[model samples]
Target: MSDTARTIGVVGAGSIGATVCADLVLHGFRVVLVDRDPAALERARRVVAEAVRFGPMLRPGLPRVGAAEALAGVTTYTALEALGGCEFVVENVSEEWETKRAVYRELDRVLPAGVGIGVNTSSIGIGRLAAETGRPELVVGIHFMNPAYLKEAVEVMRGAETSEACMAYVMGLLADLGKEGIVVGDFPGFVSNRISHLFFNEAARLVEEEGVEPAVIDQIFKRCFGHRMGPLETADLIGLDTVLLTLDSLHESYRDDRFKASAHLRALVADGRLGRKTGAGFHAYGLPAGGTGAAQG
Candidate 1:
């Protein structure tokens, strides 16, 4: 498809979804951003505006695109039916099986036949997601990092039945967005989340079981281990609820005790402390509006 003719549909208008939409718009691709919540849709609009206005300052080599022109390319909708015109769909709904299953089913019915659906999940298996869509070969995982515009690499997972043609198309799409697809085999959590969540879960255990301070743990990792962000801080950035959900999915998929969710994490989630999005998770973000910050989960 020609660049001017490509319209991408992004399901869900949370942090990841909004970031992806903004990135697409900046790259001059028409985008359809969908969400059920009016508040989230509004937030997504604001996020896109902010990204267009300030993103270039943060990322040195971004295209010199006008904010108004970029914003004009995006259309926000409350219904999935609005996505019927899109050539490709990127699903970023919550990580729960039932929620994802419902979205995939609707996407399968609403989107035109032959259009690929990218499952942007953290822990759920790509094979399971493909099965839910009834188009195993067309459904592939494209795990774009948080703040998708700034990230240069995406973890692409090929489902058991995913075709080589599907993989090539997705990799080409990523290249168009100025991202490299680090393709890997389909697995629960795949590579990044599988290893990263282990570190996060252990850090939570340390804080809960051993009474280690969150800051201290993060400091040790950053200063001693030469890491950029500590696991707890990273969890905060990812949202505690999302972290818990991914952990639950990992435990279920692996049937392992070590992947179990931590008590401290559960307590924080139960109390509405959901990390950076919630204004408080392992630490506080100064009480943002909408419970659990801006995260969809």
Candidate 2:
């Protein structure tokens, strides 16, 4: 792929979005990353440059993108109108209804007809988000995992009004990235977050109520269940603030007490200790493998 390859618009310059931009750049797609925050965009540029230079060490299958090539593949902007010429756009803004709602409204006007929109959200429903756009059928969910370049599988959610054409376009995009899309139904939290948040919330509650250390809770699941990262550790990686918003979305959507976020988790978000991104939340990106690092447990 060349620098003149198809252009994809990525809204938001957060952790996930910046990583996604790198993945797109690595695959030879010209990416236009949009955010109102110029600082965030600069940070994204640095992150992309670093990932392209060093990310292949962890995943040798990826082509080594040079600084000039990687830089050529991305352009940053502070306006939504910059996305007008993009072939496709992925929205990775904060997990807030009002913020996303406003973005979708502007996207409806900015995007040319026939272009598709991928909603890379955690808990929000594709159908509900598509409702904000004039082309509901063009919206689909693309649940990209952390460190997206390393993830080979992605959960693709189909909105009720999503057209087959839209789904195919998204599938094609994922294929270009050397990723497989596992199609799923449209719903808040969908498959991953719906159940994952429950375990995360419960893990926090156990720490608050039973006084079990966070590390202790994580160890049980890792050693006993044979899972990689424990609930709390995963939550920390995902950002505690994001976890709270996702839990709140789940609770409100289901109207079930089980989905309510734990008070302990809520407090973490309120305090601004949001995981690895902040160098704090969840003991600062959790404990090391086979761990023993007194990380705020």
Candidate 3:
């Protein structure tokens, strides 16, 4: 596909999707971001605007759009029809198989023949989703990390029936978007998540089993492992619900002991102490002047 002719449609404008769309727009690709929630679309626009302001430094010569017109190249829509003309469609919906399958079925109805469709699912089976799409050749997994702008790795998962041509196109697209796309098998918890989850799951176990304080464990990991952000802090950024959902899906799919959802993490989510989004999880954060104390849970 020619750079000038590239147009990507993104379904769901949450953090990861929004970040991906912004990065794509910066690369001069026309984008249409779809979301059901008006508030979410607005929030994504603000995120894009901030990234645009820091442009060129992030990607040389990329658009440095102002707040008002930050989302100009990208269009927002609530209906799937608006995505009809896009060359590639990326679905960044919730991590539920049913939700993702529903989205793909709808996308299959809308996308033109031969157009590429990518799922940003972390732990779901790409083969199953590909079969669900009916157009198995066009469907592939392009699992991007949170804070997509900063993360250079994108896991490219192909189903058993996925064509070599489709894989080539996806890798080329990833390269064009300034990312390194590594091909992997159709398994639960593709490369990044498989490794990253070890950090999070073990961290949770340490806190629960060894009587380790959350703060102390976080500090130890950060200092000892030379990690910039500890597992809990990363979880805070990733949203507690997402972390739980990923764990549940991986555990169910693989039935692996290592993928067991941590009891403490599940409790935190159940009590609505959803990390940074809720202003507290393992730690408390405050708004500029006056934010409340250790957020209720």
Listed in order, each prediction's TM-score against the native is: 0.93, 0.93, 0.88
- Candidate lDDT scores, in order, read 0.85, 0.85, 0.78
Cα lDDT of candidate 3 equals 0.78
Candidate 2 vs. true structure, TM-score: 0.93
Q: Which residue pairs in candidate 3 have backbone atoms (N, alpha carbon, C) closer than 3 angstroms, thus clashing? A: none
Question: Worst ten-residue run, lDDT, model 3?
Answer: 288-297
Q: State the TM-score for model 1.
A: 0.93
Task: Look at candidate 2 and give me any clashing residue pairs.
Answer: 275-281
lDDT of 2 at 51: 75
Q: Over 4 Å off in model 3, which ranges?
A: 1-5, 54-69, 286-297
Tell me which of candidates 2 and 3 scores higher on TM-score.
2
Error of 3 at 11 (Å): 0.7
Ranking by lDDT: 2, 1, 3
Give the per-residue Cα lDDT of candidate 1 at 144: 89
- Between prediction 1 and prediction 3, which has the larger TM-score? 1
Per-residue alpha-carbon lDDT of candidate 3 for residues 222-249, written as tens digits (9 for 90 to 100): 8998887888878776777888899888
Point out where model 2 deviates above 4 Å.
1-3, 285-297
Highest lDDT: which candidate?
2
lDDT of 1 by residue, 17-129 (tens): 88888888877788999999988887777777777766677776766677677777888898999999988899988889999989888888888889899999999888887
